[model samples]
Target: MKVVKIGGSVFKKENIINLAEFIVKNYEPYKTIIVVSALGRSPYPYSTDELINLFVEFKQNHSNGNNYLLDLSKSFVVSCGENIAAGLLSFAINYLNPEFKAIPLNAFQANIITTDNPIDSDIITIEIDNILRLLENKFTPVICGFQGVSKSGKLTILKRGGTDITAAFITKLMKANEIHIIKDVDGLKSAPPNIIPHCITIEKCNIDELAEATMNGNPVVNPEAINILQETNAKIIIKSIFSEKFTLSSKEIVPTQLVSNISNKDNITKFVIYLPSQMKNKTLVLDKVLKEIFENSISLDFINLDVFNNLASFIVNNNQVEKIKQILDNNQLHYKTMGRLSKVSIIGYNMRGKPGIMYRINKALLNEKISIIQAQDSHISISLLVPLKYLATTIKALHQEFFEDY
Candidate 1:
């Protein structure tokens, strides 16, 4: 079995026909399922954002302005885009192969059950027997992504990039042999091709490396989707829909491993806010502080809260420091600042049980007389906070130690 997700960017009329032909030609032997996203950037009347905006305007102008009604209405309205795309693709497939059957299925029909968050719902249960029945009868099930039905039967939409999540969930549920995410780009690149000179395309990477890149603002794929893939045995192929000579082969994500030289040099500022150690209700204070910070449109990074010392430290961009300071001052919080710091991370999926990885990283940086202010590690990544002056050196030294051909 195979699950293929066609991205919104490549859901044009001609592209849909081409995709149908490609699947019929190559995947005839397998039970294939197609997932489609809304049409992208075309002069379409019902893009997701436009649908939401239209619903809000209509509600404000015509309805009683109830919040529940607004959310419910928005969910139903925005889902139309995916439904249209799915229906169109199913039609194209059936047209191309008259002997083959293609069926368009919405979330309700496919049994994608979720929580009632309306805008960004969490999938609770997905009944797959109906999908299996379709495949058994030699039908191609074209599913509308990014939309699902709540337990209470209310229409709910997943977060933006939810189609990727939908595909991953289905792939895991069905234990599909492979997943192909058709997108506009060639594949994941080492860096943004337009910004970084001579950036190379990454042909293979584990889920950890992909997640690290996604978290560091690389828009190759959805982080949530990658999280789902981490639990499955399926290998994902991220390829361009424009490519005619692409292979179905994929780079599998190995467990407890990491790949090196993945670095983000963006300047970030670290703030350590001190709370009164004797103060009760620390949770309340922390929540209020964080709420204010988020309201200012400032995103916190590398956050660490030490409840024992009542110290909360986090990093933010230089541009958000002044606003953060004003919020702290207004709340009468005492804090210390560390500016001009850069985050260097070595990411891999196999770094979890491995020994001496940190020791080697420390030795490389120490040899250069670079001071490491702070370090954070996950199962797949070890991130260091160093001075901006050592950013390039740190990346080069770590890359040489971990990724260089020896």
Candidate 2:
């Protein structure tokens, strides 16, 4: 079975029907399931301000010992559900192309149970499996994405950009052959086309390469989706639905090549602060001072503490220089923002296992006037944190030095 997840941006009333017809025509010999996110034709109409207002009202009602906020949240969630169902059904019946069975996705049968909190929900694989089996008798199921009802019968919603997660869960449970993630773009590219005009499409990329690219801010697909694919060993092809040409090629797109081809505006330079173990309890002082510095409005990512050794590391934006110093000075923490910090990642299954992998990576960076501040070795990736300013230079230099012919 092939499980296909369509993106919200590519969602069109006509496109949905068009896609259904195409899938039935091409893969009708095999079983296929479709999952759709609430984007495009039936977009969630609630504005940010309205969502916030509803959230606040819910909170106030809870504090005042009333169920009013709970009721409001449920109503709003149902409205979203209705829009999703209506759009999908309308697309199936009215907009679909000639010669295919067009069936409306009954909202009640789709009964996705979520958590009480509309903002969060968990995937009950059992429920999902039952739903899939129910569809086995007849009909290609179209599920409402990003929203579900919990076992307790409360409506819950998935996080933003969570349709991938839903699709992944379905794929893993079904043990499907491949996942076709149809979006607006042609496939995963060597780099953002606007930045590297010469960039070409990637015909083949292993789990390792996808992970490294996604972690480094590649725009093709979400990293979490890649991680899930790794665990399930399920193949995923990210392709553009609008493209007319359909040709499959066998080319191993090198990881280092892709890494060197890209540029990201949000490249983060992390600062890992190692403090004495005894100072862990005294974090109140650091916390107070850090709060004052944070108020200056610098964006912070992944502020986490190591329980074992009382270490804290936070990722900060590449451009926030003044704010970094302000936080350091006010806290009076003995620290140094290591100047030589960049991320050099290696992604390949065959490139796995040699005692000298780290040695080779470190030696290459060292020759390029780069220093490895911290190194993390995962199953298929070796990420080295190096100097921020020299990141691009070091990655390109390393690509040419070690992986040019790979």
Candidate 3:
């Protein structure tokens, strides 16, 4: 079985017909499942965003200011977009190919069970047997993406851009051979095309790199989709739906048992908070500090809390140190600061039991005369803090040593 998720950007009528024809021509030999998003942006009244906005306006004008009712109404209203898309696409596919039976399925019809959040529900389970029965009967299932049924039988929607999550979950549940996410772009690029003049399309990437890229603001796919892919054996392919020369040779995310990628994080400041041994109410003080950190919108890059030793160390961007210090001083806590550091990491899932990997990294940096201030390693990554001036050199040496081929 193969799962293909058609994105909202290509949700035009002509595009839907084209997609239907394309599926019949290309996927005739396999059991195929199609998932479709709501229609494309503006000019399409049934687009997800437009539908949500329409609900918001209606609630403001007519609702009694009840939060729960508003949320429920929003879910019901927003889900109509996907329902329409599924119905239209199913009809198109059936019209284009009478021999192949195509049927539209909503969250309730498809038996997609999710949390009762109404607006941003997470899938709890899906009725795999029902879908299998449809396949057994030679019925092509056109599932409405981004919608689900709550345990209480209420309509719910996954958050925005959730069609990817739907596709990923269905692929995993069906144990499909692969998942293809049809988009408007050619494929994933090394960097944003407009930002990097020479950015090239990456034909292949692993889940770790794709997740990292997504976190660093690369718009490839949903991060939740990548998270799901990480736990499953399913491969994800990104392709262009608009290209006439579209082929299966687009960007692919295959399973990599272990892979490494380089990450450069600059403008870091490390803090060491010293406390008396057996300090009373340590938890309370720590909670207060954490509350202040969050209230100020400071993001911690690294943190280590040693309650037994009466020490707490954390790393944040240099710009946030002054505000953090003010909070600590106001609370009469003693701390020291190491200002202006950069964190470079070799991120991989295979570094845990791999002997000498850390040694090679340390040796390479030493050879470059780059002193490491602090080093931290998890099963997934090895991170080092160095002087800001040495960051570029450290990244170069490490990238050359570990990820040259990548």
Q: On a 0 to 100 scale, what is the lDDT of residue 269 in model 1?
A: 90
* Candidate 3 Cα deviation (angstroms), residue 45: 2.9
Local lDDT at 66 for model 3: 76
Worst-scoring 10-residue span by lDDT in model 2: 245-254
lDDT of 2 by residue, 30-124 (tens): 26666666545323344222444555666777655446456546545433633564356435633553232334343235665555555645556
Query: Number of the top candidate by TM-score?
Result: 1
TM-score of each: 0.75, 0.65, 0.69
Q: How many residue pairs clash (N, CA or C atoms closer than 3 angstroms) in each of the candidate models, in the order given?
A: 7, 12, 0
CA shift of 306, model 1, Å:
6.0
Number of clashing residue pairs, candidate 2 = 12
Flag the better candidate by TM-score, 1 or 2. 1
After superposing candidate 2 on the true structure, give the runs of residues whose Cα lies further than 4 Å from its correct spot: 13-21, 40-82, 85-108, 126-134, 231-233, 244-269, 274-346, 354-379, 384-406
Give all candidates' CA lDDT scores: 0.78, 0.58, 0.77
Residue 347 in candidate 2, Cα distance off native in Å: 2.5
Estimate the lDDT of model 3.
0.77
| Residue-level error in angstroms, candidate 2, position 341 | 8.3
